[model samples]
Target: MGSLVASRPVYIPLSPCPRLPAPCSSWYSCSPYCLLQILVTFENLAAWGRCLCAVCPSPTTIVTSGASAVVCVWELGMAKGRPRGLHLKQALYGHTQAVTCLAASVTFSLLGTIVSCAGAHLSLWNVNGQSLASITTAWGPEGAITCCCVIEGPAWDTSHVIITGSQDGMVRVSVSWAE
Candidate 1:
């Protein structure tokens, strides 16, 4: 039998939570991945929970948990031909619960992105970092988004829509673009 080898797992600590009793979780990725967004859930006095968001050329990597929304924007740049440390660009907030799932697409006119929350709400953010609109009953009162995907719509249709799966065992298709 061949021997088994285990590699060390990379550990990256996230920003500290200002207030205690409120847990803070974070996730991030570095260069060569094409995506650099962190999902952080930390409670503050003003906002119960906030998710930082940033838009890049194309999002290729995203780390999320439960209904926690994606938070934090870090731009990975090179200095002296070496990759520099990540810096906080901005913080995005728009969900009450954890972000269950989110996706980006270019198939439609200006869909940009779709974010689903465990609270059964869906939000559309444009490429310019503007919130186009939000829907409270994206799935239904009993629906909790579990997963989602974005793809080109029917061949005859010029626009595209977002497809989602929820805890209610229902698959939903909804418009992504804002008026």
Candidate 2:
């Protein structure tokens, strides 16, 4: 006769508290089980959100402020426990309405800068959370900024340009001197 064997089960708990504020619009993670970023959307407040924290390895993590809320990079791994508090590095506050989009520069290592787009404006910021520069849109008649990107040239000079897709279905591209 064959002997019977038993199997064991494992369990994991859901987040104890709401990880995001009201109206979380988007989120991204950098690695599996390691880092996380979240975007929250709100109304009539600051009109924009801020990146809360970057996990260890410094610049490998990037955060962006959007029209409705802030966005962060997320990773999947052993949860390191909820962040107690996040330090504010830089802030791009000029738009009267919500910031709609954000984008970071392609990082080569753990220490690099990120560029963000907010409602027809583009801002360059450092890893330590300092705003290098903020420029308004030059190419479009704007009410809200929907998206942005950082383009690098052959000479390593990055062109900080923003393509804002408006509610009116128009796309406008603007260049920033901050780049």
lDDT of 2 at 15: 38
Identify the runs in model 2 with alpha carbons over 4 angstroms from their true place. 1-59, 66-97, 108-113, 138-142, 177-179
Local error of candidate 1 at 128, Å?
2.4
Count of clashing residue pairs in every prediction: 9, 24
Give stretches of model 1 more than 4 Å off: 1-70, 78-83, 106-111, 138-142, 152-159
Model 1 C-alpha lDDT per residue in residues 70-163, reported as the tens digit of each score? 4443344446654334444434567776765666554323444535445588766654456766786554556877676666665555454777
The predictions' CA RMSDs to the true structure, in order, are 14.6, 14.8
What are the per-residue Cα lDDT tens digits for candidate 2 across 16-88? Answer: 3346453332233322232333322222323334332222323324354544434333322223553322333
Per-residue error for 169 in candidate 1, Å, reads: 0.4
Which pairs in model 1 have colliding backbones?
Answer: 51-71, 52-71, 52-72, 52-92, 67-98, 67-99, 68-98, 68-99, 69-99
Q: Estimate the lDDT of model 1.
A: 0.50
In angstroms, give how far residue 30 of model 2 lies from its true place: 27
TM-scores for all candidates: the values are 0.51, 0.42
